[model samples]
Target: MRVVSLVPSLTEAVAVTLPGVLVGATEWCTHPAGLDVARIGGTKNPDVPAIVALRPDLVLANEEENRAPDLAALRAAGIEVLVTEVRELPQAIRELDRALRACGASARPRWLDEAETAWLRLPPLQGRLRAVVPIWRRPWMVLGRATFAGDLLARLGVDNVYADHAERYPRVPLDELRGTRPDLVVLPDEPYRFTPDDGPEAFEAPAVLVSGRHLTWYGPSLGEAAGVLATALGR
Candidate 1:
């Protein structure tokens, strides 16, 4: 079955699981380095015509990462689009299983099982640290309530200061985020590509750079997320 994936994490999941089944993917879907698939475009603004031209049997997408209008356009063109909603780790695993099955994967990949075991085996945190996780700068957007990143951090004993906020991704002033006085400022290198020279100096707390794929992506990377993120957090 031919598949075109718009979500980066799902793209990696399908590519690594079923190899040549992935015929097309977004430009942002940069995993399994040396992936030689047709580039459709970015998550927010995918090239509908280019994707339709691929003649894929299934199109993988996410409710959060992909734009609604693009998915609608794909469906209007008679493409079978599988939209996955993964708000947390458990949901991500379940949804990935469903997506793979829908795309005609014969069996569950070992990475999925490994990812589950990795998270489940993580020792309970001795103490929790209050944190403010900033995803972007300039305007300053942070991980708010009910975000996958927030839940992942919570599991790692890092509590997001704005986890109780109404919006999942809230845009707040830089001074307001500093006002929270978090113990640590966790930074991920995607969406905005926050780096040590760019992100850390603004905050009073020590900022630790983390792999965006581990912190955010929900594919094979999850198997190593616990260990990698723990080490990055200095646990």
Candidate 2:
């Protein structure tokens, strides 16, 4: 079964699980290091014509990563599209299972099992830290309510300062974020590539740089996320 994936994490999941089944993927789907699939453009603005030309049996997309119009266009073109909504670790795992089965996977991949074990085996947090996690820098967008990243952090005993905000990814004034007086500021290396020298200086609280993939990507990297995030939070 030929598949074209628009979501980066889902792309990695499919590619790593079923090798050559992935015939196309978005330019942002950068995993498996040396993936040689046809590039269909970025997640938000995928080339619909190019994707349709691939003649894939299934097109995978995420509720957040992809634009609705693009998915609609694909469906209008008569292409079968599978849209996955993964708001948390558990949802991601379940969605991965569903997607793989839909794509004709005979058995669950070991990495999927390993990811589940990794998250489940995480030790209960001894203490909780209130944190403000910034995803973008220019306008200062932060992780807000119902976000996967926020849920992941919560599971690790880090509570998001704006977890109750109405917006999932809200753009807030820097002053407002600082006013929250969070105990820690966690920075990821994507969407804005926040570094130790870059992100830490702006906050009064100590900041720790973390792998964006581990923090956000819901695929094989999840197997290492618990340990990696724990080490970063510990430091």
Q: For candidate 1, what is the total of clashing residue pairs?
A: 0
lDDT of each: 0.92, 0.93
lDDT (10s digit) by residue, model 2, range 120-221: 988867989999999998899999999899899999999999999999999999999999999999999998999878888999998989999999999888
What are the candidates' C-alpha RMSDs?
0.8, 0.9
Which regions in candidate 1 have their CA more than 4 angstroms from the true location?
Answer: none
Candidate 1 vs. truth: CA RMSD? 0.8
Instruction: Indicate the TM-score of model 1.
Output: 0.98
| Clashes within 3 Å, all models in order | 0, 0
> Once superposed on the true structure, which residue ranges of model 2 sit more than 4 Å away at CA?
none
lDDT of 1 by residue, 137-174 (tens): 98899999988888889889999999999999999999
